[model samples]
Target: MSEIVYGNLLYPQDDTPDETVLGCIRGARDVGVTTFDTADIYGMFRSENLLGRALAGEPREELVLCTKVGMPTAGGPNGRGLSRKHILESVDGSLRRLRVDHIDVYTAHRYDPETPIEEVMWTFAELVRSGKVLYMGMSEWPVESITEASRLAQELHVPLVCHMPRYSMLWRVPESEVFKTCDDLGIGQITYFTLEQGVLTGKYLPGVDWPAGSRGTDLKGGRGPLMRHWLDADDALTRIQRLAPLAEDSGLSLAQLAVAWVLQHPSVAGAVIGASRPEQLHHNAEASGRPLEADLMSRIDQILGGDLIVHSA
Candidate 1:
């Protein structure tokens, strides 16, 4: 799988046309990005539809298509969770939208407290056996839940291959327990929020107004609130800005530096990145295979400081 997976979350934005979004997706593929990640709940299912249209003619065997279920897509009680009915129903909808016979990876978008772990594992196993999904995994699941599911997966013969976690320089909670547990279970991590919602990209400067059209200013769609935790912290912004000089010294953009930092982890199989433009995708793809020296890593740690980073859950 490609280390840089194009994430179709907020892409194909309400304001952006389908042609522009398709162009960006194709541009990512042009830059050697073979893995594309999306979910049924993302963009209320439009993302999967658009991604399906974008990659319709490509050789299916050469690409890795991933999507998630278990998020509420409708108002009814049966509309969500990892129950057999939901998973069984959701997979067919995902297949129809993605225009694919089998998803390379099908993940539980989040842990469902209402469902039994055994049922979840067994349902996923059935999908694998039925050829609707190739592998199974989870995103943002609790550590105990992951361990329990991993155990159940073993008994059910499900191929639980990866864990999707929110990991970045600013958010280091996964390092405390998730990484070790996944590593022990022989599962690789495909991390999201590697750029801290564009904060680590050096676009939001300390003591300065957010750049026009940035996530910080997007009050609609709840993006602004999602980024408020970082945007409201000037000290964190200041520290993030300090990394710019280091990024330049290494001949890398701040976004590339941020993405590379997550990829540095041994357990990280890939980093999912979202981009509105093709050039952004091209720039981030360069972070793959680039190693930051130990000295640089230590310097980054010192600059961000212990208090600003979240090292535990």
Candidate 2:
């Protein structure tokens, strides 16, 4: 990989208990995950508390901790968006919730169209100057919003160093321009959905029963095409099946294949993998150094046929 290791992982804000949450974090670190990605809004701040407990006694210097703001913490008119008050309040709250002195790379969880870019950029600049946050950026932001933010930050002399978005074979919207923009601006791209919510794990074969808790079958409000509502429940099942041979050719598990494929994109800084268990994390860790042959990569592109995903720059 690129000099930077992929340890910054996303921990979903569901009802997972402390034991389960901490177990996963410790499990990740035990297996060499040196960075973690979380947000103030994750799990209604539940995940952060558990994550904070997990890193309580660890050596802080050995890790890169990042958390995000801009989303509502308790859900209210003022509780959400990228207003100066929300950004300032939540950055401190994220620091408190994470139980860390300062966040390594604090990001706007998403863009806030209502807020002025100057206020948002300088708010983080103030955080950095106050030594509360080291660096700042935005995630899941549209290209124009990001461009405007970067421009304002630059004009104000504040550093915006990262851009977080979803990028995978299933969701290639970022490929269009966000990747190129990241390259041009020298901003790091941290991508989530690298496995398409476990869709590319290759276990959801056609006609097979849904595994007990697989995201496709059981994840409530999952972003999947429904057979009843859209097409059949097996939507995209066939397309994924066509991807198997390429994965096998590279000597990788399908999940590894998906993540590795994303890594092939030069603009990607880190692919956030969600681990429900220790063994699953081990599988992801192995993907870090595996190389995808050029022919195998080309084959995957052919399998996922369609017009290329485009995002306005």
lDDT of 1 by residue, 239-265 (tens): 898999999999999999999999998
Which TM-score value belongs to model 2?
0.90
Best by lDDT: 1
Regions of model 1 farther than 4 Å from truth:
11-13, 222-224
Clash count of each predicted structure: 0, 3
lDDT of each: 0.90, 0.73
Error of 2 at 103 (Å): 0.6
lDDT by residue (tens digit), candidate 2, 194-303 = 77677778777777776776655544434355222211435467677778777777788888888888887778867788777767887876788676788887777777
Q: How many Å off is the CA of 286 in candidate 2?
A: 0.6
- The local distance difference test score of model 2 is 0.73
